[model samples]
Target: MATKRWWVLGCVVLVVAASALAVAQLRKRDFQAICDGAVRGGSLRYAIGDGGIKASDVDELDSELPFGRLSECRASAEDDSTGLTVAVGNLESSSLMSELSGHRDLTGLSGTSAPMGGGWPGVLTVKNKDIAYATVVLKCGRSAPHEGILVNVKQMLVEGEGNFSSDKRKRLKLAQSGAAIASDVSKKWECGSQLGGEVDRAPDDVAVNKPLPLSQATGTCRAMRPLAATAKKWGITRAASTGSDSRAPAQDCVLSNSKGDRVYRLSALYGPLEAGFRKSSSSLFQVSGKAGRKEKNPGWAWAGAKCPDGSDAALFTASSIEHSKENKRLIVGAEFETKMLGAFARDLGGRRGCDDPSLPTG
Candidate 1:
């Protein structure tokens, strides 16, 4: 009898161990599924979970959360002019909870706090009579450590709206509905790795003072760091090279003022004759110049104009070289009416070359 009892006890222990192992494996698989989905841009929908709220605008706020190991997903919906934004974050419960409380105080928002069922805490705050926001931090009772979810919702009243008193009931209902949906989503939430796959190519090949390859340089404008003097004078801190083509390897460099409100583009083109050049050059002329004038540089052309905003602009184009027998032609042009256009065009022409060079220094 003792021997039989021992055999039965051992079998029971084995069964229990197997069950525990199976559960663990399932949990791991679930976490991996969330991560995979996130990287594929499915997290936007997944974050909403089973909530009946349909999101018309969904955007990934960030690949990683600001605190701890976390990821965030954002979704928004608009009814007429009113809008609601939902933001979800997956992280540690304790960390999320602390962050939410801290944020509430830091933002100077008057909020009502309450404990939610299932280890969740929520805060609701109203920003004036037209806007309201709420946050809920939830923790699943699963075996995972530091696992938590955060949901934030913000609602904006339509334009010309009065106080919330008129629609208090409706507002309360919406808030309650949002909270319930958030809780449901929290229960299904799982922390995942950084979202999105790496792009196959580098984001930008253009570098200050560094020349790009002909293939990369052609047809694409490279943004370059602006010189200090140029940046200060016209607030032009950023510059780019673009518009290279096959027929003649033509290219253009664009410069933006500090406010990024204005832009200047410079280009050089080659053709067989003046008539051939005109065919290619007319577009540049029409776009930059309504009037023309003789510039200081020999064989160079210049034009000036007043923008609708009362800002001045100018365009400069000139034939760099003329070949009679071969009928080969090279035209250089710069467009900007600011005080700095003359100097800028001269500098650009000096640096014109096929080899990608580092961005010019101030």
Candidate 2:
């Protein structure tokens, strides 16, 4: 009798273990499905497919289980001139929740909170003025030990008529569609724990007087002395001159490499940027300097154009603090192989801190 009882106990344990394993695998697949549907769903395609815009270059979807069974998936798509990317992930840490709460200001965005699927709440914000961008964050549900699902969607207006008022409305519509997609995905996954009430706001903590790093500015352009070697290496033997700018003083210098195939134009603008300027700046390049590409560093925001010589010219802008009371803007334009634009922008950003008094010559 005792031997028969032991055998039966072992069999029961094995059956329970197998059942748990199967459930775990199914959960993982469900998370992946949510991610895939967000990118490939017909509704998303139809939302952005209007007005001669065609979606192409849909990148491969990526999903991963990182840190304590937390699953994440991300995907991106590109249209004629605009880019869209979405990421959905299961939140597993209190620290992550705190971080999300800290960014609740929405900067320049204006929107109201709405209840999402499963009674979870979410905030949607859209920027439609001088710059066009949109963002949405949805709270799915909570799990034991305080885990949840957070969905984020970001879209950038790369190409459109410069008119912001009309463009803003169009961007808002797209943003709403994105939020709907996130809600649907949240429901499908059935994340536990409802995020109660409206979205909360934290106090702003940015230090307006923080000093900017100046290690990159080592050469002088006024006397054309310290940069002499750089100019020589690049085959730019011409003396650096202070170019003309009427609004807020600025300095400009043009140089080219020995082959004359690569040209670099550097400009520095002095004075404070207009109010709310930073808030409206597009976040498309916030992740990677290039839209539709992921990189290791937060690069300068930039745009590119094709030059007459069959080379590509790219322009980038970086903001810095000259001192406690003053702020400066640096703009660099380089003509080089399209693939080298990001590296060139980083190089220019490092060189903007020069101590030359002749910089920004009024």
Candidate 3:
């Protein structure tokens, strides 16, 4: 009898192991399908500079969580006004408790709409009032059949109002419903990565002109160092090349006025209303040439910080005037336009960036 019991136990173990392995394989396949679908179906043009998420890797925000399984994976195809939104979820599991404890920092995320459950076993809160939400829980890390993602998304907007605390809870729950439209659609999970395609025509805004001093220009004719230093600090290893000169390598340059220099440019892009609501964007700026030296229209270049890390490096060039045209133009373009006013509406939004909470003081 004892011998038979041992045999049964061994067989049970083997079956469990096999089942685990099969589950892992299924999850991997599912995730891959999700990735492919995202790429094929999604579209959020506007090539990002170096910094956003990568193509193949999953961003923290996009991964499964709290412990659950994915029931659906699809993409939306819409105009730039309303981008595609993705929805994913997880299978119910007891292990979710452990996973939530492990990542408690992220779980009871403060400043969101709903207050964290008071020592509640499993719950999440959201702050954004404009959207609804959904919830699924999963463990962290990618393990075989056992590993997966649980995603909840904004489904729809809430209509009625309640008491302060009740309203907060309702809004939070609404925000958790992940069934509605998704804005800012893209294929990759990483928010830092850039997706190349087309962007809608951004609206215009009052021009801003931030001019720096002209004395701080550094580097030789071929390469500039001041702006290069800034780029390097920002993890940019490559240098920007411009002009017709092939013999000389690409280099970095800086913009200067008689006053001190400001490295980064801050700007905003208003939303659809075009009244006041606007997002922010960032860029690396460079200006060359002299105030009146009669050189090529004083150098004028603006590089957005939207790429992956340091990939797209474009140089600005203007025709050299015998004296007046390029000189006067450089002053206006570099000093009055690009530096201060900015290139476009979205340019400002790109500079402001997500998660940067500080409001721009007028």
Q: Cα deviation in Å at residue 291, candidate 2? A: 37
Q: How far off is residue 40 in model 1, in Å?
A: 19
In candidate 1, residue 234 scores what lDDT? 36
State the RMSD for candidate 1.
24.3
Error of 3 at 95 (Å): 41
- For residues 264-360, write the lDDT of model 1, one tens digit per residue: 3433321111112232322322222332433443223432222222321222232222334574332223332322334433343233322221221
Q: For candidate 3, lDDT tens digit of each residue in 269-357?
A: 11110111111011112222211112254332222222223321222221111223332222333333332222221222233231212
lDDT of each: 0.35, 0.32, 0.26
Model 2 local distance difference test score: 0.32
TM-score of each: 0.31, 0.32, 0.21
List RMSD in Å for every model shown. 24.3, 22.1, 21.8
Model 3 accuracy (lDDT, Cα): 0.26
Model 2 Cα lDDT, one tens digit per residue, 174-253: 44545455555555566443333321221111121111111222221232334445445434443222212121111223
- Supply the TM-score for candidate 1: 0.31
Worst 10 residues of 2 by lDDT: 203-212
Pitting candidate 1 against candidate 2, the one with the higher TM-score is 2
